[model samples]
Target: MSDFVTPVLLMQTLAAVREAGRIITEAWEKPRSIKYKGPIDLVTETDVAVETFLGKRLREILPEANVLGEEGSPAARPEGTTWIIDPVDGTTNFAHSIPQCGISLALWRNDTVEMGIVYLPAEDELFHAVRGEGAFLNGKEISVTDESDVEHALVATGFPYSIREDIDIVMQNLRAVLMTTQGVRRFGSAATDLAYTACGRFDAYYEIRLKPWDLAAGWLLVEEAGGKVTLYDGVTPFDFGKGILASNGKVHKAVAALITDTDD
Candidate 1:
């Protein structure tokens, strides 16, 4: 792996995600055609259109890297760099014109994420992070909140599309969190929630069974913003396939214990 992320590389990656934002923005302006990927999952013409644009743009930006996009893209290049892209994070919301969706992108290399960018086109908010440079919002530096009291913390969360099969589990966790934290929010977009947590809009965020594209960018943003991210156990490392617990470091352990407490 390279020792550092170059400025050119960062700029190009940011441009690709932003271009993706522009694509979604333009698509949102016109009539929208929506489709269902499953009973609860949604797909839109804009999702495919933006994915195609991102697939091409990202490869052009980093020819050496492979792409894994949510909308029918190829598998990742395991040995080299990989760009993970979620063309539209909240397709249902986008289809409903709810303006809660965004594009999520992340770059992975040598078993670690090097950069992440989440763009909410409707809101014109761009949240980005370089591994060591800290997180930013539309070029302005941002940080996680310092709230340590779980009862006073505002946390965000989402129900995964897999909720159909895991409704009970989702509900159990939701109930636990609702009682433990000051409040809970369901924003329909895990990527957006994580960005909000990174920027101190929310003190913590957690969710289960999310895809790589959904968690990759957001996880990096939280970490770079001086937050802690881990599995529900708070000791296990966070990966896309498992449940996640992210907080502003101060409340991380308390939240994790609550979420992972079996007797609750």
Candidate 2:
């Protein structure tokens, strides 16, 4: 564990996140004031409100750590301790009164994640992990699936917001994965996908063109749960740029081969 992470700090962080979760739940009950960032991309007032609250509270909790949120934040930050947050990971689902959305928060420093928490307030499921420790949902420990066969694995994925230009590639990879895996699911939330993978709910999860806030926390959760995370090539490290594929380690290479068509 990093010198920055302590039991008290972790508890403080979780309390702040749970408070943020209350904000999401409150906003979710009423109609959302939605705005489109792009043709299909969404940003709700709830998203902004939660991010704002998190920014304020987290700053108070860790005075040294800067906040990098999905909303109103720089695309990247310099080397330092930072809080990477997705106020609402599944805004579309939340807008539709679905229960799959959640708040994703991670303590990131010097290219490593010290801790991560993905809390679905609507469903009341909170998944968290600390480096060198293990993953947990609510309070129970969690781990990735042990399945090693691609044909029997249940996979999860999401398309990029810029899907219009990458439809060909998205569909191509989707088709290959669908044929290879026993089943495929798109929950419309990258954070949820990774959290589910960490808890063994999904054997693997992959996507392209994701921001740091979306993958930062879940990245550590997957690894802590004894899984593997990488780009489509299966060897390259993910710098929060694109092509993220996370699996149970047992079936990582096989799924990567399917997505990249390297098996052919």
Q: Which candidate is the best by lDDT?
A: 2
What tens-digit string does per-residue lDDT give for candidate 2 at 2-106? Answer: 576899998998999999999988877788899998899899999999999999999898988888999978657425889998999988999998898989999
Q: List pairs with backbone clashes in candidate 1.
A: none
The lDDT, on a scale of 0 to 1, for candidate 1 is 0.85
Best by TM-score: 2
lDDT of 1 by residue, 67-133 (tens): 8888876553223588888999988889877787999998888777888999999999999998989
What's the residue-level lDDT of 212 in candidate 1?
A: 83
What C-alpha lDDT do the candidate models reach, one value each? 0.85, 0.89
TM-score of 1: 0.94
Model 1: weakest 10-residue lDDT segment is 255-264
lDDT of 2 at 149: 86
